[model samples]
Target chain A: MQTETDLVTGPAPHWHEGVSIIDAMQDVLLALIPITITGILIFGTGALLVIITCVTGAVLGEIVARRFKGEQTNLGDGTAVVTGLLLALTLPPTAWWAVVPLYTLGGFLSVAIFREAMGGLGRNRFNPALMGRVFLLFGRTTLVYLAPYLIDFNPAFTPWLEELEVVDVMAKATPLLRVVEGMELPSYSTLLAIYEGGSPAETSALAVILGIIYLIYRGRISWRIPITTVTGVFLLSLFLGQDPLFQVLSGGLLFGVGFMATDWVTRPVTDTGKIIYGLGIAVLVVFFRQFIAELWIGYGGVAFSILIMNGFVRYIDKLTARRVYGQKK
Target chain B: MAEKTFRGGIHLPYFKDLSSGKEIERVPVPEEIIIPLKQSIGAACEPTVKPGEKVEAGDIVGDSEEFVSAPLHTGLPGVVKAIEPRITGTGSKIKSVIIKVDKNFSAAKPDKARNAEEVSKEEIIKAVRKAGIVGMGGAAFPTPVKLTPPDDKKVDTVIINGCECEPFLTCDYRVMLEKPKELLQGSKFLMQTMEADKCFIAIEENKMKAVNNLRKHNTFSNIDVLALPSIYPQGSEKQLIQAILDREVPEGGLPFDVGVLVQNVGTTVAIYDAVIYDKPLTERVVTVTGPNINKPANLLTWIGSPVKNLLEKCGGIKNKPARVVMGGPMTGTALSELDAPIVKSSLGLVVMTVEDSSLDVDDFRPCVRCERCIKACPIGLYPNYLSMAMEENNVVEAEKWDAMSCIECGICSYVCMSKRPIVYLIKKAKEKIQENKSD
Candidate 1:
């Protein structure tokens, strides 16, 4: 007969659903495989190198931040890897080598500052990967200003830039940039097949849809955000007298809606809140793509729109809160 | 036909197969029986039997003048050894009557059975009160008190809750299957006593065998057998009412408020025994099964049998159980010791092994705003927000979020990816709020 000390006791529920943070994070990583492969197939070794560097930097940054906060490192959770891969997929392929340090800094700051500084994973208000991408986007002017001096100081850099063979293939204007520049648009089949001159993840809408399907099948995400986002973008673009198909297929819209905007921690929790947040991002994306793109070249409307909506998630959750059972509406 | 169901409950992996197939074997009377005087939810009963007094199996050991409380009866023919406070399955110390079982005692046959149709409504209620029967489905609320609602409230429908939706619990299902006639007769007595027009015997689709059995034995036109979806809290009173009659009991109210009354199948059977055989609440079928048990089976255990004896009847533990829960896994109380005796509400003894109860407090993560808890809550309250409020010790915020409305079904904690003990925190918050209110 065992004594009472041999028994373990806790709360009423002696069973669990067997889901863990590690499993969920691993599911996200698994879902990103198709899109990551498509990105590599379109942009070659440059995209692969960027993905590797960013993921490594994010993981290292997570360790450093945890150590600094006097907390045990949670490197096995895979959240840092997700942040890094997402940030890498949003960057232009050709610019990978030239801005390696800057993007690495972006990755580091994403985990260390945006995520860990706000008390880590689920507590962060903004999507850390988007915050990282937006950081690099804000520094675009500084890079462009230093481009001439750097070329003059190091002539080898010019030839090294030219050595990127995939650059010539994507030298043509991207579809969304064409919309901004009033250039002729490509056919819908061409866009869906292998669109170039955009971020690595933006290369194939087919790949992004495949990843979304996997996430949905794994029950890691719901259709409330992504479906509402796509519908909202399509109808709103048409309402604004724009080509809805071109708008939906171009830029980082599909990738953002699939990967970044559907982030569990940064988005609203309820179904109704997710729909409202999705539509809110759609409106801002249209406003930024059509109007704000002219003011700033290669404007990342999806990143900014998602971050802005992330701010209102608390309010959205509060407003659309479910009525208590048996309580009248 | 489409199976009836309510929204927001999880599909649990019902481990009923462990004991569902085993016939309920009668456990031999142990050397000692510790009967807690206060098994029901209301006021505690005072001990009526003195130490050294000889008692019969059907003798009343305790009684109370309170209208809400039920009397206590011993199931063993023995001498009262002592009267003291003893811990019960729920982890509360209550005044109890300890009896030493007689070595040479024979089971007494019940008196001639009375016809149910000839009994008056008042007579049925009197018999139920005399039987000291409570809601055997875990709440242990006095059945007679529930049968007697206010005059203004009209209870037209009676729901016989045979859902047994809790995982690893097959006692109720066994009762429904083996004693279908008694259950139907009990249902008739409940409907007659409550003046209800219709009675629905609700069983989850997973228990189609029991549903078919009950339907086959059922002869009354007014009694209908319903097959509901196998959701975790499908047997919960409010959800059961909503799924069957499409009536919503008002907030902070009860099934009686919505012209409905729900009685568990075990309680219904007890009502049958009470009304017909003049038997008091004594032995009940309890499922003693889990992954750690050597022999998982259902036992017809006496009311005051120690959990250790019940476990011994199941061939003892295969390994050191990580958790010994007193009821179903979803809403059961984890027992700290095996000394606590089974009471009126003890439904099952689930002995979880280390692998089954692997939830670690160290692995708890912050809420990722996943809304799984919100979606899984049958009551439709925001469990995540309520958990956050309680964590910060904000009682007002917790109250605003309807913390009191939480049924503590443990669904929020079970489905939480972060493994946060949301229901535990919510329970703490409810306690804090109640303290403030009394202040």
Candidate 2:
């Protein structure tokens, strides 16, 4: 009953809007609203600029990738925008202007090239934003160190990157490193200052908390990874006699745990796997911050831990699967 | 007390205003009806009536080829015109029998009203199977087959899915308001058939009017009316079962695995018709709404009616339709061809029109690994990796990640900020993988 032309069109006659995937993606963007709002409120305008820039970069990166591949552009999916916003949140507030293009390029490479080639979106194991941040940190560490000055570090002065103090930028260590190194705890008020005691992104523990709560509320991400990561860090810090509050609120620990490390794709799927994943990051973060004395590598620790766990997710899922009725494994 | 709402359900402005109060208006029958053979899940029925044969409403035009398939019945008294291939709601092209309605063909409306009396289990089952009733909750899976619990399993509870949880569709709500008695009767019949210990009707708290109306005059004491927390996919059989009975339909298994049978309210009403009047599944109440549909109202449309006919009935297209779906916006399939016929499982025919097409597809870009899809998935499957495995043509990896367990609810696709076609990718993976397995 089939015609010759049917072979070229493929099997089975069907009609679809060719818009199914796009609609699905839109729904995801809408769901991220609450957490994105929390991020904007916490980091102020610097974070907002990062969000806008990252989203724009992500879209542009996809378009460029599609162009390079000689394929039709699907810039309408908003996947790039999501990548941009997520990458922005993970960046240091005082990061150099050069870091924006570097990270955006990295995101395109990881998300558009590697991830897209592996299959775009949900198929990628490594989070694009995290990959972008990691790429920037590793590839141009010198430039990243200079990134905070490129953007307007002074929120009261101009709030735009072009209006910032150029060469007179002051260097500061994150709070987690200070606590691990046995420095006296800065007063809560001082700790909340603009990129002084910690990274601008994680300086405001209050904002991270709000974002985390919003994520949990929206069910955009699970509480298991973040809750377990935060809990593990807090409990492990208590064991090491480090201040739990500093560990919880320091560096990108909150942002990493609340946002990145808990990424559903790279992290293990099973509850047991999630717990292991969280605990692994906690241990690595502590080791990096304390023994290595490298708080600079703390965020990298989360990325590495996720990469390791992503490899072992299959076995972990097998071990954690519920026993099906009337089936012998 | 904690709110049982799940994470990641979108809250769009529900435009259920027009049809919420207006009684369902029966639209005029089309000149010709194109009835798809495989409307329900499982194998498509083989045609029994050949071309040039006269057929009447309730006459079986197609016979079931397998235990899973439902028989096809004529929706109108007409002359058998042609049996040709046509596209279905799922976008799959299947052989459909087209019947041209005879002029002056206002046949007698089958008597559907019934007395408040208990029906025997066997009679209910037989009637439901004969009526070709499927889950009108959009799946259109044969309802009787679902009710018949396996011999090995025991069903003690039947849950009525009144969640209508999908944001825009209000056909269930209109049904609840208009014919609570029929739904209640259908529930009773289902309870009796399943030999259930109890029955529960789960309605969202938002549908206060329907809840109140059902509660005030509800006759079935055995059927407890519980107001469930409003959540997307709460209308899904497994999710609804979890919320009401606290029973989990095991991953990679049917609801019978959990010793529960979930039925949509509309499907229940269809059962009432099947049992009371021997009426075959023909006409169904469809919600023709959304921004693009003008004068939005709940319609009693016949099976095989074209999308254009219904849109025209709803005062034509309000604006340039960005997308046309056969069900709710969340789980509904986008109509690539408006000529596709309305089938038995249709609950609402939605026409969404937004100024920005970006809202439809942001741009198929790279996934940022936000974990939004993972969090939003009620089944807890990792869509990101699964989509990857599918892309690589690695069925083993996809299967390992529990790809088969995916209910295909589109939640992952919906929640993905990257606007990635996670659902489509996964669907393609599932198809390719299944094809490989079969080979």
lDDT of 2 by residue, B290-393 (tens): 76777788889888888767877888766653466678776677676666788888888777654322223334545555556665677767787676566567
Off by over 4 Å in 2: A1-282, A285-329, B1-13, B109-119, B354-363
Question: How many backbone clashes does every candidate have?
Answer: 0, 34
What lDDT tens digits, residue by residue, belong to model 2 across residues A1-329?
22222111111111122334445445455545554565455445555655666677677777776677676776665556666666765665443455556665766665566456654545565666777777755765555466545344455554465564332222444565555466666666554433343333555666666666776776556688888888988898899987776666667777777667666556666667777777878877766665665545545565555555566765665676543222233
Each predicted model: what fraction of the native A–B Cα contacts (within 8 Å) does it retain?
0.74, 0.06
Worst lDDT run of 10 residues, candidate 2 chain A, spans A6-15
> Which segments of model 1 are wrong by more than 4 Å?
A95-98, A146-148, A151-172, B361-363
TM-score of chain A of each: 0.93, 0.73
Could you tell me which residue pairs clash in candidate 1? none
For each candidate, what's the DockQ? 0.67, 0.12
Q: Would candidate 1 be rated incorrect, acceptable, medium or high by CAPRI criteria?
A: medium
At residue B213, give the lDDT of candidate 1: 95
